[model samples]
Target: MATAWFPLWLTLKVALLATLGSGVVGILLALLIARSRLWLRDGLDGVIMLPMVLPPTVLGYYLIVVVGRNGMLGRWLYERFGVSLIFTWQGAVLAASIVSLPLIYKAARAAFEEVDPSLENAARLLGSGEAAVFLRVTLPLALRGIGAGLMLSFARAMGEFGATLMIAGNLPGRTQTLSIAIYDAVQAGDDHRAGLLSLLMSAVCITLLFLSGRLLRARHRA
Candidate 1:
Protein backbone atom coordinates (compact mmCIF):
# COMPACT_ATOMS: atom_id res chain seq x y z
CA MET A 1 0.00 0.00 0.00
CA ALA A 2 0.92 3.67 0.04
CA THR A 3 2.18 3.39 3.59
CA ALA A 4 4.41 0.48 2.71
CA TRP A 5 5.88 2.40 -0.26
CA PHE A 6 6.88 5.42 1.80
CA PRO A 7 9.98 3.78 3.25
CA LEU A 8 11.08 2.67 -0.19
CA TRP A 9 10.83 6.16 -1.66
CA LEU A 10 12.43 7.72 1.37
CA THR A 11 15.31 5.27 1.28
CA LEU A 12 15.95 6.04 -2.39
CA LYS A 13 15.87 9.75 -1.69
CA VAL A 14 18.31 9.53 1.20
CA ALA A 15 20.66 7.14 -0.61
CA LEU A 16 20.75 9.29 -3.76
CA LEU A 17 21.45 12.48 -1.88
CA ALA A 18 23.98 10.90 0.44
CA THR A 19 25.85 9.24 -2.38
CA LEU A 20 25.98 12.49 -4.37
CA GLY A 21 27.14 14.59 -1.46
CA SER A 22 29.71 12.07 -0.37
CA GLY A 23 30.91 11.46 -3.91
CA VAL A 24 31.78 15.12 -4.43
CA VAL A 25 33.42 15.47 -1.06
CA GLY A 26 35.22 12.17 -1.31
CA ILE A 27 36.66 12.90 -4.73
CA LEU A 28 37.87 16.30 -3.63
CA LEU A 29 39.52 14.83 -0.56
CA ALA A 30 41.08 12.08 -2.63
CA LEU A 31 42.51 14.60 -5.05
CA LEU A 32 43.95 16.70 -2.27
CA ILE A 33 45.46 13.73 -0.48
CA ALA A 34 46.78 12.27 -3.68
CA ARG A 35 48.73 15.41 -4.52
CA SER A 36 49.84 16.30 -1.04
CA ARG A 37 53.29 15.61 0.43
CA LEU A 38 52.31 16.35 4.00
CA TRP A 39 53.21 14.03 6.84
CA LEU A 40 49.62 14.08 8.14
CA ARG A 41 48.21 12.45 4.99
CA ASP A 42 48.34 8.99 6.50
CA GLY A 43 46.65 10.13 9.67
CA LEU A 44 43.94 11.87 7.71
CA ASP A 45 43.38 8.75 5.63
CA GLY A 46 43.12 6.63 8.74
CA VAL A 47 40.47 8.86 10.26
CA ILE A 48 38.41 8.96 7.10
CA MET A 49 38.66 5.20 6.64
CA LEU A 50 37.83 4.39 10.26
CA PRO A 51 34.08 4.12 9.79
CA MET A 52 34.45 1.27 7.34
CA VAL A 53 36.05 -0.96 9.95
CA LEU A 54 34.40 0.42 13.04
CA PRO A 55 31.20 -1.01 14.49
CA PRO A 56 28.00 0.64 13.37
CA THR A 57 26.92 1.10 16.97
CA VAL A 58 30.21 2.80 17.76
CA LEU A 59 29.81 5.18 14.83
CA GLY A 60 26.26 5.87 15.90
CA TYR A 61 27.43 6.72 19.40
CA TYR A 62 30.01 9.13 18.01
CA LEU A 63 27.40 10.78 15.82
CA ILE A 64 25.14 11.27 18.81
CA VAL A 65 27.92 12.80 20.87
CA VAL A 66 28.91 15.13 18.04
CA VAL A 67 25.44 16.16 16.94
CA GLY A 68 23.21 15.64 19.94
CA ARG A 69 21.28 18.55 21.51
CA ASN A 70 23.96 19.35 24.07
CA GLY A 71 26.82 18.58 21.71
CA MET A 72 29.04 21.45 20.54
CA LEU A 73 28.08 21.77 16.86
CA GLY A 74 24.55 20.61 17.50
CA ARG A 75 24.02 23.20 20.23
CA TRP A 76 25.44 25.98 18.10
CA LEU A 77 23.20 25.15 15.14
CA TYR A 78 20.13 24.87 17.37
CA GLU A 79 20.82 28.16 19.20
CA ARG A 80 21.60 30.12 16.05
CA PHE A 81 19.23 28.76 13.40
CA GLY A 82 16.89 26.44 15.25
CA VAL A 83 18.03 23.69 12.90
CA SER A 84 18.07 20.28 14.49
CA LEU A 85 19.37 17.16 12.72
CA ILE A 86 18.66 14.65 15.46
CA PHE A 87 15.67 12.42 14.64
CA THR A 88 15.23 14.10 11.27
CA TRP A 89 15.57 12.79 7.69
CA GLN A 90 18.58 15.07 7.31
CA GLY A 91 20.16 13.21 10.19
CA ALA A 92 19.55 9.97 8.40
CA VAL A 93 21.31 11.34 5.34
CA LEU A 94 24.21 12.50 7.47
CA ALA A 95 24.50 9.06 9.07
CA ALA A 96 24.45 7.32 5.74
CA SER A 97 27.03 9.70 4.27
CA ILE A 98 29.46 9.22 7.12
CA VAL A 99 29.31 5.44 7.04
CA SER A 100 29.67 5.20 3.27
CA LEU A 101 32.34 7.84 2.86
CA PRO A 102 35.26 5.46 3.17
CA LEU A 103 34.23 3.33 0.24
CA ILE A 104 34.05 6.34 -2.05
CA TYR A 105 37.22 7.89 -0.70
CA LYS A 106 39.36 4.80 -1.06
CA ALA A 107 38.20 4.00 -4.55
CA ALA A 108 38.57 7.56 -5.75
CA ARG A 109 42.01 7.81 -4.18
CA ALA A 110 43.21 4.69 -5.94
CA ALA A 111 41.86 5.95 -9.23
CA PHE A 112 43.53 9.29 -8.86
CA GLU A 113 46.80 7.69 -7.85
CA GLU A 114 46.77 5.50 -10.93
CA VAL A 115 46.59 8.42 -13.30
CA ASP A 116 49.86 8.99 -15.18
CA PRO A 117 51.73 11.99 -13.82
CA SER A 118 53.39 12.45 -17.19
CA LEU A 119 50.06 13.12 -18.84
CA GLU A 120 49.13 15.74 -16.29
CA ASN A 121 52.57 17.32 -16.64
CA ALA A 122 52.23 17.40 -20.41
CA ALA A 123 48.89 19.15 -20.14
CA ARG A 124 50.33 21.62 -17.67
CA LEU A 125 53.28 22.39 -19.96
CA LEU A 126 50.89 22.97 -22.84
CA GLY A 127 49.31 25.98 -21.13
CA SER A 128 46.61 23.97 -19.30
CA GLY A 129 46.15 24.91 -15.67
CA GLU A 130 46.04 22.37 -12.88
CA ALA A 131 42.26 22.41 -12.84
CA ALA A 132 42.03 21.93 -16.59
CA VAL A 133 44.44 18.98 -16.56
CA PHE A 134 42.56 17.33 -13.77
CA LEU A 135 39.14 17.84 -15.29
CA ARG A 136 40.06 16.96 -18.86
CA VAL A 137 42.64 14.22 -18.43
CA THR A 138 42.74 12.84 -14.91
CA LEU A 139 39.04 12.82 -14.24
CA PRO A 140 38.18 11.27 -17.58
CA LEU A 141 40.58 8.42 -16.95
CA ALA A 142 39.31 7.94 -13.42
CA LEU A 143 35.63 8.33 -14.20
CA ARG A 144 34.92 4.62 -14.33
CA GLY A 145 36.53 3.99 -10.97
CA ILE A 146 34.73 6.96 -9.41
CA GLY A 147 31.46 5.64 -10.85
CA ALA A 148 32.07 2.31 -9.18
CA GLY A 149 32.76 4.07 -5.90
CA LEU A 150 29.55 6.05 -6.22
CA MET A 151 27.54 2.88 -6.70
CA LEU A 152 29.24 1.19 -3.78
CA SER A 153 28.58 4.20 -1.57
CA PHE A 154 24.97 4.28 -2.74
CA ALA A 155 24.52 0.66 -1.74
CA ARG A 156 26.06 1.25 1.66
CA ALA A 157 23.86 4.29 2.26
CA MET A 158 20.74 2.37 1.25
CA GLY A 159 21.57 -0.47 3.63
CA GLU A 160 22.46 1.77 6.57
CA PHE A 161 20.49 0.74 9.67
CA GLY A 162 22.11 1.01 13.06
CA ALA A 163 23.64 4.48 12.75
CA THR A 164 20.56 5.78 10.98
CA LEU A 165 18.23 4.35 13.60
CA MET A 166 20.32 5.81 16.39
CA ILE A 167 20.33 9.33 14.97
CA ALA A 168 17.15 9.47 12.88
CA GLY A 169 14.93 7.08 14.85
CA ASN A 170 12.32 4.87 13.21
CA LEU A 171 9.65 7.41 12.58
CA PRO A 172 7.52 6.22 9.68
CA GLY A 173 7.35 8.45 6.61
CA ARG A 174 9.87 10.81 8.17
CA THR A 175 13.22 9.24 8.94
CA GLN A 176 12.47 5.54 8.60
CA THR A 177 14.52 4.17 5.72
CA LEU A 178 14.12 0.73 4.17
CA SER A 179 16.65 -0.90 6.46
CA ILE A 180 15.07 0.67 9.55
CA ALA A 181 11.62 -0.10 8.24
CA ILE A 182 12.54 -3.77 7.94
CA TYR A 183 13.77 -3.82 11.51
CA ASP A 184 10.72 -1.99 12.78
CA ALA A 185 8.36 -4.32 10.89
CA VAL A 186 10.03 -7.34 12.41
CA GLN A 187 9.93 -5.91 15.90
CA ALA A 188 6.26 -5.12 15.47
CA GLY A 189 5.56 -8.74 14.38
CA ASP A 190 4.83 -7.81 10.81
CA ASP A 191 6.69 -10.68 9.20
CA HIS A 192 5.17 -10.11 5.75
CA ARG A 193 6.25 -6.51 5.61
CA ALA A 194 9.69 -7.35 6.90
CA GLY A 195 10.16 -10.07 4.34
CA LEU A 196 9.03 -7.81 1.52
CA LEU A 197 11.37 -5.06 2.59
CA SER A 198 14.25 -7.48 2.92
CA LEU A 199 13.73 -8.79 -0.59
CA LEU A 200 13.54 -5.27 -1.97
CA MET A 201 16.74 -4.28 -0.19
CA SER A 202 18.53 -7.33 -1.51
CA ALA A 203 17.44 -6.63 -5.06
CA VAL A 204 18.54 -3.04 -4.94
CA CYS A 205 21.89 -3.84 -3.38
CA ILE A 206 22.52 -6.55 -5.95
CA THR A 207 21.73 -4.21 -8.80
CA LEU A 208 24.06 -1.53 -7.56
CA LEU A 209 26.86 -3.99 -6.97
CA PHE A 210 26.39 -5.46 -10.41
CA LEU A 211 26.70 -2.04 -11.97
CA SER A 212 29.77 -1.33 -9.88
CA GLY A 213 31.42 -4.50 -11.06
CA ARG A 214 30.70 -3.55 -14.64
CA LEU A 215 32.31 -0.19 -14.12
CA LEU A 216 35.38 -1.76 -12.57
CA ARG A 217 35.78 -4.20 -15.45
CA ALA A 218 35.39 -1.36 -17.93
CA ARG A 219 38.03 0.60 -16.13
CA HIS A 220 40.37 -2.36 -16.29
CA ARG A 221 39.75 -2.68 -20.01
CA ALA A 222 40.42 0.98 -20.65
Candidate 2:
Protein backbone atom coordinates (compact mmCIF):
# COMPACT_ATOMS: atom_id res chain seq x y z
CA MET A 1 0.00 0.00 0.00
CA ALA A 2 2.70 2.46 0.92
CA THR A 3 4.84 1.59 -2.06
CA ALA A 4 1.95 2.09 -4.46
CA TRP A 5 1.06 5.70 -3.62
CA PHE A 6 3.98 7.54 -5.17
CA PRO A 7 3.98 5.46 -8.33
CA LEU A 8 0.27 6.01 -8.78
CA TRP A 9 0.63 9.73 -8.21
CA LEU A 10 3.53 9.93 -10.63
CA THR A 11 1.49 8.04 -13.21
CA LEU A 12 -1.35 10.51 -12.79
CA LYS A 13 1.07 13.41 -13.21
CA VAL A 14 2.47 11.93 -16.40
CA ALA A 15 -1.02 11.37 -17.77
CA LEU A 16 -2.04 14.92 -16.89
CA LEU A 17 0.98 16.44 -18.58
CA ALA A 18 0.58 14.28 -21.66
CA THR A 19 -3.12 15.14 -21.88
CA LEU A 20 -2.48 18.90 -21.68
CA GLY A 21 0.38 18.79 -24.15
CA SER A 22 -1.56 16.66 -26.60
CA GLY A 23 -4.75 18.70 -26.14
CA VAL A 24 -2.94 21.90 -27.08
CA VAL A 25 -1.26 20.36 -30.09
CA GLY A 26 -4.40 18.54 -31.15
CA ILE A 27 -6.59 21.65 -30.90
CA LEU A 28 -4.12 23.75 -32.85
CA LEU A 29 -3.78 21.12 -35.54
CA ALA A 30 -7.52 20.66 -35.76
CA LEU A 31 -8.02 24.40 -36.15
CA LEU A 32 -5.49 24.52 -38.93
CA ILE A 33 -7.07 21.53 -40.64
CA ALA A 34 -10.55 23.02 -40.39
CA ARG A 35 -9.39 26.30 -41.90
CA SER A 36 -7.47 24.79 -44.77
CA ARG A 37 -8.77 25.33 -48.29
CA LEU A 38 -6.50 22.95 -50.17
CA TRP A 39 -7.26 19.30 -50.85
CA LEU A 40 -4.23 18.53 -48.73
CA ARG A 41 -6.38 19.12 -45.67
CA ASP A 42 -8.08 15.77 -46.14
CA GLY A 43 -4.75 14.00 -46.47
CA LEU A 44 -3.28 15.73 -43.48
CA ASP A 45 -6.38 15.10 -41.45
CA GLY A 46 -6.28 11.38 -42.22
CA VAL A 47 -2.61 11.18 -41.33
CA ILE A 48 -3.09 12.97 -38.07
CA MET A 49 -5.89 10.59 -37.13
CA LEU A 50 -4.13 7.48 -38.31
CA PRO A 51 -2.72 6.69 -34.91
CA MET A 52 -6.20 6.29 -33.47
CA VAL A 53 -7.00 3.55 -35.96
CA LEU A 54 -3.69 1.70 -35.86
CA PRO A 55 -2.63 -1.13 -33.59
CA PRO A 56 -0.95 0.05 -30.40
CA THR A 57 1.84 -2.49 -30.66
CA VAL A 58 2.63 -1.41 -34.21
CA LEU A 59 2.73 2.20 -33.16
CA GLY A 60 4.99 1.36 -30.24
CA TYR A 61 7.33 -0.62 -32.43
CA TYR A 62 7.76 2.29 -34.82
CA LEU A 63 8.20 4.72 -31.97
CA ILE A 64 10.85 2.44 -30.59
CA VAL A 65 12.68 2.55 -33.93
CA VAL A 66 12.52 6.32 -33.99
CA VAL A 67 13.26 7.06 -30.33
CA GLY A 68 14.94 3.92 -29.00
CA ARG A 69 18.62 4.06 -28.13
CA ASN A 70 19.62 2.00 -31.18
CA GLY A 71 17.32 4.01 -33.48
CA MET A 72 18.29 7.04 -35.58
CA LEU A 73 17.02 10.01 -33.59
CA GLY A 74 17.59 8.09 -30.38
CA ARG A 75 21.25 7.64 -31.17
CA TRP A 76 21.65 11.33 -31.84
CA LEU A 77 19.91 12.30 -28.60
CA TYR A 78 22.11 9.92 -26.60
CA GLU A 79 25.25 11.22 -28.27
CA ARG A 80 24.51 14.92 -27.78
CA PHE A 81 22.10 15.36 -24.88
CA GLY A 82 22.73 12.03 -23.17
CA VAL A 83 18.96 11.64 -23.23
CA SER A 84 17.09 8.46 -24.06
CA LEU A 85 13.36 7.94 -24.35
CA ILE A 86 13.20 4.17 -24.43
CA PHE A 87 11.93 2.64 -21.19
CA THR A 88 11.74 6.09 -19.61
CA TRP A 89 8.84 7.98 -18.05
CA GLN A 90 9.05 10.57 -20.81
CA GLY A 91 8.68 7.79 -23.35
CA ALA A 92 5.53 6.65 -21.59
CA VAL A 93 4.21 10.21 -21.86
CA LEU A 94 5.06 10.31 -25.53
CA ALA A 95 3.22 7.07 -26.17
CA ALA A 96 0.18 8.29 -24.29
CA SER A 97 0.19 11.59 -26.16
CA ILE A 98 0.26 9.95 -29.55
CA VAL A 99 -2.48 7.49 -28.67
CA SER A 100 -4.83 10.11 -27.20
CA LEU A 101 -4.19 12.85 -29.79
CA PRO A 102 -7.12 11.89 -32.00
CA LEU A 103 -9.69 12.30 -29.25
CA ILE A 104 -8.81 15.97 -28.80
CA TYR A 105 -8.36 16.61 -32.49
CA LYS A 106 -11.73 15.22 -33.42
CA ALA A 107 -13.56 17.15 -30.71
CA ALA A 108 -11.76 20.43 -31.42
CA ARG A 109 -12.19 20.05 -35.18
CA ALA A 110 -15.93 19.57 -34.77
CA ALA A 111 -16.09 22.62 -32.55
CA PHE A 112 -14.08 24.75 -34.95
CA GLU A 113 -16.07 23.53 -37.95
CA GLU A 114 -19.38 24.39 -36.28
CA VAL A 115 -18.36 28.00 -35.82
CA ASP A 116 -19.61 30.27 -38.58
CA PRO A 117 -16.85 31.32 -40.96
CA SER A 118 -18.54 34.69 -41.20
CA LEU A 119 -17.79 35.28 -37.54
CA GLU A 120 -14.10 35.01 -38.26
CA ASN A 121 -14.48 37.21 -41.31
CA ALA A 122 -16.37 39.80 -39.29
CA ALA A 123 -13.64 39.78 -36.67
CA ARG A 124 -11.07 40.29 -39.42
CA LEU A 125 -13.06 43.21 -40.76
CA LEU A 126 -13.02 44.71 -37.25
CA GLY A 127 -9.17 44.80 -37.40
CA SER A 128 -8.63 41.59 -35.51
CA GLY A 129 -5.96 39.39 -37.01
CA GLU A 130 -6.41 35.65 -37.59
CA ALA A 131 -4.65 34.74 -34.36
CA ALA A 132 -6.66 37.24 -32.38
CA VAL A 133 -9.94 36.03 -33.83
CA PHE A 134 -9.07 32.42 -33.04
CA LEU A 135 -8.00 33.20 -29.48
CA ARG A 136 -10.91 35.48 -28.71
CA VAL A 137 -13.93 34.70 -30.84
CA THR A 138 -13.37 31.09 -31.81
CA LEU A 139 -11.76 29.36 -28.84
CA PRO A 140 -13.89 31.15 -26.24
CA LEU A 141 -17.12 30.00 -27.85
CA ALA A 142 -15.77 26.47 -28.22
CA LEU A 143 -14.62 26.05 -24.65
CA ARG A 144 -17.05 23.27 -23.86
CA GLY A 145 -15.99 21.19 -26.85
CA ILE A 146 -12.34 21.77 -26.01
CA GLY A 147 -13.06 20.78 -22.45
CA ALA A 148 -14.64 17.53 -23.57
CA GLY A 149 -11.65 16.86 -25.75
CA LEU A 150 -9.24 17.48 -22.91
CA MET A 151 -11.17 15.23 -20.55
CA LEU A 152 -11.35 12.41 -23.02
CA SER A 153 -7.68 12.73 -23.86
CA PHE A 154 -6.76 12.63 -20.20
CA ALA A 155 -8.87 9.54 -19.66
CA ARG A 156 -7.29 7.84 -22.64
CA ALA A 157 -3.81 8.67 -21.43
CA MET A 158 -4.57 7.34 -17.98
CA GLY A 159 -5.61 3.98 -19.39
CA GLU A 160 -2.97 3.64 -22.08
CA PHE A 161 -1.17 0.30 -21.78
CA GLY A 162 0.01 -1.67 -24.78
CA ALA A 163 2.12 1.04 -26.40
CA THR A 164 3.43 2.35 -23.12
CA LEU A 165 4.41 -1.17 -22.14
CA MET A 166 6.16 -1.75 -25.42
CA ILE A 167 8.10 1.50 -25.43
CA ALA A 168 8.65 2.17 -21.75
CA GLY A 169 8.66 -1.40 -20.33
CA ASN A 170 7.59 -2.25 -16.80
CA LEU A 171 10.06 -0.58 -14.44
CA PRO A 172 8.51 0.05 -11.04
CA GLY A 173 9.13 3.42 -9.39
CA ARG A 174 10.22 4.61 -12.78
CA THR A 175 8.09 3.73 -15.78
CA GLN A 176 5.45 1.39 -14.38
CA THR A 177 2.27 3.45 -14.68
CA LEU A 178 -1.18 2.56 -13.38
CA SER A 179 -2.20 0.37 -16.29
CA ILE A 180 1.08 -1.49 -16.21
CA ALA A 181 0.82 -1.88 -12.49
CA ILE A 182 -2.59 -3.42 -12.81
CA TYR A 183 -1.27 -5.84 -15.39
CA ASP A 184 1.64 -6.81 -13.22
CA ALA A 185 -0.62 -7.38 -10.24
CA VAL A 186 -2.97 -9.62 -12.16
CA GLN A 187 -0.21 -11.57 -13.85
CA ALA A 188 1.54 -12.15 -10.56
CA GLY A 189 -1.68 -13.69 -9.10
CA ASP A 190 -2.26 -10.74 -6.85
CA ASP A 191 -5.94 -10.69 -7.62
CA HIS A 192 -6.87 -8.53 -4.66
CA ARG A 193 -4.61 -5.67 -5.65
CA ALA A 194 -5.57 -6.05 -9.28
CA GLY A 195 -9.23 -5.80 -8.34
CA LEU A 196 -8.61 -2.62 -6.42
CA LEU A 197 -6.62 -1.06 -9.24
CA SER A 198 -9.25 -2.05 -11.80
CA LEU A 199 -11.97 -0.47 -9.74
CA LEU A 200 -9.97 2.70 -9.40
CA MET A 201 -9.23 2.87 -13.12
CA SER A 202 -12.85 2.24 -14.04
CA ALA A 203 -14.06 4.89 -11.62
CA VAL A 204 -11.70 7.47 -13.02
CA CYS A 205 -12.55 6.77 -16.65
CA ILE A 206 -16.28 6.76 -16.03
CA THR A 207 -16.13 9.98 -14.05
CA LEU A 208 -14.27 11.72 -16.82
CA LEU A 209 -16.76 10.53 -19.43
CA PHE A 210 -19.71 11.60 -17.30
CA LEU A 211 -18.25 15.04 -16.70
CA SER A 212 -17.33 15.45 -20.33
CA GLY A 213 -20.86 14.61 -21.41
CA ARG A 214 -22.27 17.17 -19.03
CA LEU A 215 -19.97 19.86 -20.41
CA LEU A 216 -20.77 18.94 -23.98
CA ARG A 217 -24.49 19.03 -23.29
CA ALA A 218 -24.22 22.37 -21.56
CA ARG A 219 -22.28 23.75 -24.50
CA HIS A 220 -24.90 22.51 -26.88
CA ARG A 221 -27.60 24.31 -24.95
CA ALA A 222 -25.54 27.48 -24.84
Choose the strongest candidate by lDDT: 1
Residue 214 lDDT (model 2): 81
Error of 2 at 142 (Å): 1.8
lDDT of 1 by residue, 3-24 (tens): 7688989999999999988998
Clashes of 1: 0
lDDT at position 71, candidate 1:
85
TM-score of each: 0.93, 0.91
> Which stretches in model 1 have alpha-carbon errors above 4 Å?
210-222
Tens digits of per-residue lDDT, candidate 2, 37-148, equal 9779989989889889999999999999998989999999999999999989999999999999999999999988888889989999999987899898998877877887
Candidate 2 — which residues are off by over 4 angstroms? 207-222
Candidate 2: give the clashing pairs.
none
